[model samples]
Target: MDYVDTFITVAEDCAAQTGVVPKPRGGRDTVAVLQHRMISAAPYRLTQGDVLFSTWLLQQGVDPATVPPEDPRRAEFFAVDRACLRASPLPKTHGWGLHFDAEGRVALVAVDDPRYADLHDSAGKVVKAMRSSRAR
Candidate 1:
């Protein structure tokens, strides 16, 4: 679900005390790396849907140019329930927090950044990132 005026804090089980920039593994972008690239490159410019769709497109090796909004691919993709940013590894492992503005545009904030603290304390809604592992 898209969150408006919400701040998703780092997971309680996250080990990193500060935000760590995710790196490509095996010279290929993993989901976390792709998300980091997109969110960091354009803070608050893209909504949750935009980030999720773009990342999925890149991972599928589908050129976005070939799949216009009118294409059925997007509809087919979203037809099934997809996890939201709360499940994203950025906040769960990479020490980044996600802030959704009033318009639901998302931005990345480092866990240790003052802005994160401010958002955590002041956002209209606050939620923690989903834990990486199930609790024993």
Candidate 2:
């Protein structure tokens, strides 16, 4: 119920000026998909790095099955040091919030969801996604 650390949480109503949409394809929102993959994969869950790689692949309309480790394009995805999930459109452009487990894996929590309120008050450390509009 107390607070110290902070992260940005841009609600859906606030996104129009920036032109960021929750789910550009009109299906599952990006953060939700990330959460689903992380949860289902469990012991093999993706680190933030993997999620960033996969998210971009999905956005590009690639066939997921076609991407193997040896694929030439795989290198292109990792060229960046890491994908800052905190700055991802999923949370900044969508209502989703992010929480990291002890192992540093991520799962999404919606800003309006009850769990968001709980975590916001939790002793555990959690951060809202950052916004492009503001400097950190």
Candidate 3:
């Protein structure tokens, strides 16, 4: 399956597990927003391996926030981390990069790229959701 399919599949599973529904929107904009949210809401306790995979998923338009806690996609997601994929290594790829910080929260660096910036606003919505959830 292509990235879009992978993203939708993962999103569906995440929604089922987390009870967080992803609003469907047409075009690249929706994908971008979802991807940003995934990166931002991913659990800080993720293993280094998970962190690497989460980064790759972010590029592929998977939102961590929407990921089902028990989704199999998370296995593949974490696998990428084990492989240690790097954005600088594949600069030509449309959406391939890993951005994380010492705090484990999704750093803004990933969104800084022109390709990712467009989704920042939508991702902000997801971040708010995450904050609310954490506050509870």
Off by over 4 Å in 1: none
lDDT of 3 by residue, 56-120 (tens): 56667676557766778876555553432221112112232333334433322322255334433
Q: Say which candidate scores most in lDDT.
A: 1
Q: What C-alpha lDDT, on a 0 to 100 scale, does residue 35 get in candidate 1?
A: 92
**Pairwise lDDT winner, candidates 1 and 3:** 1
Worst 10 residues of 1 by lDDT: 63-72
Q: Rate the local accuracy (lDDT) of all candidates.
A: 0.91, 0.55, 0.35
Provide the clashing-pair count of each candidate structure.
Answer: 0, 0, 5
Model 2, global lDDT: 0.55
In model 1, state the lDDT of residue 32: 97
Error of 1 at 21 (Å): 0.6
| lDDT (10s digit) by residue, model 2, range 9-124 | 44434353332334325565465455345434552245565566666677687655578857766676676565476666656665656565555565555566676677678726
Instruction: Please state the error at residue 106 of candidate 3 in Å.
Output: 12
In order of appearance, the predictions have TM-scores of 0.94, 0.57, 0.27
RMSD of each: 1.3, 7.1, 16.2
By lDDT, the better pick of 1 and 2 is: 1
